[model samples]
Target chain A: MDLLGINPVLLIASLMVSATPILLAAIGETVVEKSGVLNLGVEGMMIVGAVVGFITAVNTENPAIGFVTAAIAGALLSTIFATLVLYLKSNQVATGLGLTLVGLGISALLGKPYEGIKSPTLQSLDIPILSDIPIFGRMLFSHDAMVYVSILIVGLVWYTLKYTRVGLVLRAVGENHDAAHALGYKVIRIRFLAIMFGGACSGLGGAYISLVRVPQWTEGMTAGAGWIALAIVVFASWKPWRTLIGAYLFGGITVLQLNLQAAGVAIPVEYLSMSPFLITIAVLVIISARGNQGAPASLGRPFHASN
Target chain B: MIHFEKRLNPSRITTVVTPIIAVILTMIAGGIMFAALGKPPLEAIRIIFWDPLFDPNFASYSRPQLLVKAGPLILIAIGLSIGFKAGIWNIGAEGQYILGAVFGAAVALAAYPADSVLLFPAMVVAGAFGGWLWAMIPAILRTKFNTNEILVSLMLVYVAESILASVAQGLLKNPEGYGFPGSRNLQQYPSAFNAEVIANSGMHWGVISAFIAVIFAYVMMTRHIRGFEVRLMGEAPKAARFSGVSTTRLVVFCLGISGALAGLAGMFEVSGPSGQITIDFNSGYGFTAIIVAFLGRLHPIGILLAGLLMALTYIGGELAQLMLGLPGASIQLFQGMLLLFLLATDIFTNYRIRIGGSN
Candidate 1:
């Protein structure tokens, strides 16, 4: 029931909750990279989603509306990046960094009034028969709608990327945009859509933090979850299913660290708190060292039709 | 419909003008934002851009603050521009900055009650080493394991922050004061204090170092073979490789120098303006320096001016925060706008717009 003064059941439940945001963000970014576009503004998009979602939920008293608006806001923000990088041919890295700065600054300004104000949170959806089952049900089947949605999204991404015609085109574009363009595929248009999708997913992840996770408005509440999601994409080698695993692993670590701190573990609190980032670095090194980094060949490369 | 045609040679005028245009655009957009927030747009603009330099009431105080603020930004940005020139991104200058401060402060703290003339200089070296050590993590990883330096460096930022928080509360805590989560104030120590070389003029050792860096960078970039290799690598990797440029060495050198400069900036800051190692000592200077680098067009002299301009915004933003009831974040929003516009307008530098072109 308990491991090291921590409840495994509760830990699993909370890990599912904590991992949802990162899973959503990483899955979206995988698609974006697959289209030969790299958006490093995940943190910015996530925070924007957090603030906008929290504000909407507080004002409308509807968590669903909050999430929808958050997605819209994120998509809208990503359009700026899409235009700059895809159309104007701005440096992808610098533009992405700019998006983050804009997102952080704008989110802070918007969330200023909503600070400390609690918003409507989602209720756990208990499937009747599953709820009646024993410990396994509690561990797996008792999460909110978004949790199910996140897993469902991952499944959809995996299937789409593996088997679909659209996925094939996206892969072609990512592998070599000029060749894709030569084949008469619309590279810029596809990348634009991919970026927007990425923004929306990042937004949803951010809203998950502000709504279900913390259930309140806080400036920079997402912290480095967005960045971690980015790391997960790499650790997953751009695979959706692996992203889920990476997210869960990260979520578990986060929860375990918090629990350890609460239980007054002998290790210094700061060291415990820093474990997730350190682990991220370790995983990144391990994945890269294996020689099959599996990154999209055209990842982070700016595309121009003439070029 | 309009389309862009790549210029055979990028327009020199547009290269200089685009940043100015970007600034003007940001002001207009920021004004609209301020108006939306129920503040007077024109007055807010004046407070942010104009008042910091010429508003008689605040100028004398703010003018000196400019160099104090610009010093670190220029130092860090100058270092970053070098790596950026080589197409090497070191966005983790923020982490490097933190480690530098921690390392530099550690030397002073460990040598507490000793008034040796060498204390300050020793701290400076320690600060640079700390930053270099931290930067080496990503550099070594990139060279050996082929990991993305951007992610690794950024992740280390959180690690460094954790270290900062730990030391502030544990090892570096001020023993004479009540148990507070910060190191001893280095400003109070005569030997460690980074005093203003000229009173009220803000010409401190850090500002002097920034000037020196600018001059050094200018010379190296224009005259040195290493600088040519860096530029060549960014422009054409194949060509640089053909010329026998070692990618590993370039990566290491760029990351190393940038990290050292970022660390030096942090050292100057903790010993001077910040005065101690605290949880919130770094106020996003590392990140802001990125914008400064771009705005300066990665040119040393340009970065100096850009750093000063950025420092002006910081002072003016503070003035606006006090004079007008604008939120502190609005300034961040303004700076972000500046960078976005700069990027957006940069197309003019490299392309000629063709109206009614059928391609």
Candidate 2:
């Protein structure tokens, strides 16, 4: 069925694809924050992932290998942030900004050669039985492998955080690093691993954009998706399940705007283009106004054993 | 194995020495990067750090360009340093700068045919107001709703960009220029042009304002009670609150001042150096100012020096881009490396390394 000269089914399908990158990034950041470390370099990590992924996919002619390399690159970059903030005690915010600068610059440098070249895009995976099951099948089951992986990752995160001993330890560290340290838990090591995982997820998200969404390399292609993912983490109240909802909502807005522009809607294109960021601000205000921000106690605080 | 011991007092010497060490380290690392890119490392390094000032072929042209570039950076960085000292992060100075330009340019555009001598000053006020208005969104939201200003301010940057794009294409489009998307070039308008006070000296109103801001910031920081309160708010928020410092007021004031300054910088740029408002008018000066603020150790005089040094790298980087086949992004990478090294080396200021010591 069509609404305002737009196909609802196609819009739903496209939004699922569009939301995967943000969903992956937000889920990853949620875990990092849960471990009492805040890495504000999500944009940096994602853009680097996008370029490295694009380069690898183009060279190897395998989108899978491209994604793998992007994750590795993202993790490697986050190691710089982890070492600086965790070991050397650099300011997390400044170091994160530096990481972004480095990521954007380095990505542009690396992606320069690959700018116009198109990589092998990800193919959609259709589950046999689900694919044949009418309208719901087309809406849900038909998507690239990464979309399914993103949702699966969200479910896994939810289950792990709610029921696993690992989750309990991570929560303990985030709530009180001193207590966790006193209790013989390795705060730094746990936090380091969490940060790397976050980086990897962010990398995958970026690769999704380069490989599946845009299907080509471009400088600064991630273009504030990383930042939006950050806001989504807050909008989701740091919950994994809510992150899925938040991503979908934002993805829907993005798709709707594009569709509206294509359909020649009466509203000014500038106003429509700016709606997502404006909505983000409004959402932040609303979420924060309700009083229970639910942020980790030691979220941005530095951890030192002697202290 | 080495371990760190907390110092009773942060070392005064290391505070000054670390930044220098960071710069040297950045050059070495940046040289290595250039070599990896298949260029001569030494030449690239020399071109970036040395050639702009001492290279006879480019010095005359690049030397004056230094003040033109450093002026806005210093102005924005000085304002940012204050809020940073209060532990308030206003990373959206980029948005504020853009709004300032849009607002300032609007005044010039509105009074297109007028030749009043007061037009430029009126535009300056409007520019500052625009930045202040943009900044106030985050400030008010943070104070009233307890929202994170960093995210809000940054998101508004995108919003401001949309506005800038809209105005450039719609409301502010130069009517006489056929179908171009940018606003009227303000440099041609005598009443609104921010011209150099001295010929070939690059001593425009913006550069003079930057100097005034530096002096004003230094005096306020060293002598004013508000300065002490700002420092206290950053160092120890609890104590500052207990001592009757209003958190809300400080947040509003700091954000307001920084926004206004950023706006002023934007105004100067659009009217003088930039000459017109276009889609890509802002070239990341607001974001770069954050690094300048930190590199200066959040000190006014230090920012003055750091702003000039940062500007040197910009000019030098451009020279390298012209002289060598290096990508434009290499300069960004170099600056990023500088900030990273600075952060890594800053550890020495507050802690001492103990070799093979047992806790």
The best candidate by lDDT is: 1
At residue B142, what lDDT does model 1 achieve? Answer: 96
The list of candidate 2 runs beyond 4 A from truth reads A1-3
List, residue by residue over B221-337, the lDDT tens digit for candidate 2: 999999999999998999999999999999999999999999999999999999999999999999899989989989999899999999999998898888888999989988998
Give lDDT tens digits, candidate 2, residues A1-307.
2246888888899999989999999999999998988788999999999999999999999999999999999999999999999999999888988999999999999999888888999899888999778887898898889999999999999998889999989989998999999999999999999999999999999999999999988898998999999999999998999999999999999999989888888888999999999998899899999973778899989987883
Error of 2 at A293 (Å): 3.1
Please write out the lDDT profile of model 1 over residues A226-297, one tens digit for every residue. Answer: 899999999999988999999999999999989888888889999999999999999999999997467899
| Residue pairs with clashing backbones, model 2 | none
What does the lDDT read for residue B216 in candidate 2? Answer: 92
- Write out fnat for all predictions, comma-separated: 0.79, 0.79
lDDT of 1 at B176: 77
TM-score of chain B of each: 0.99, 0.98
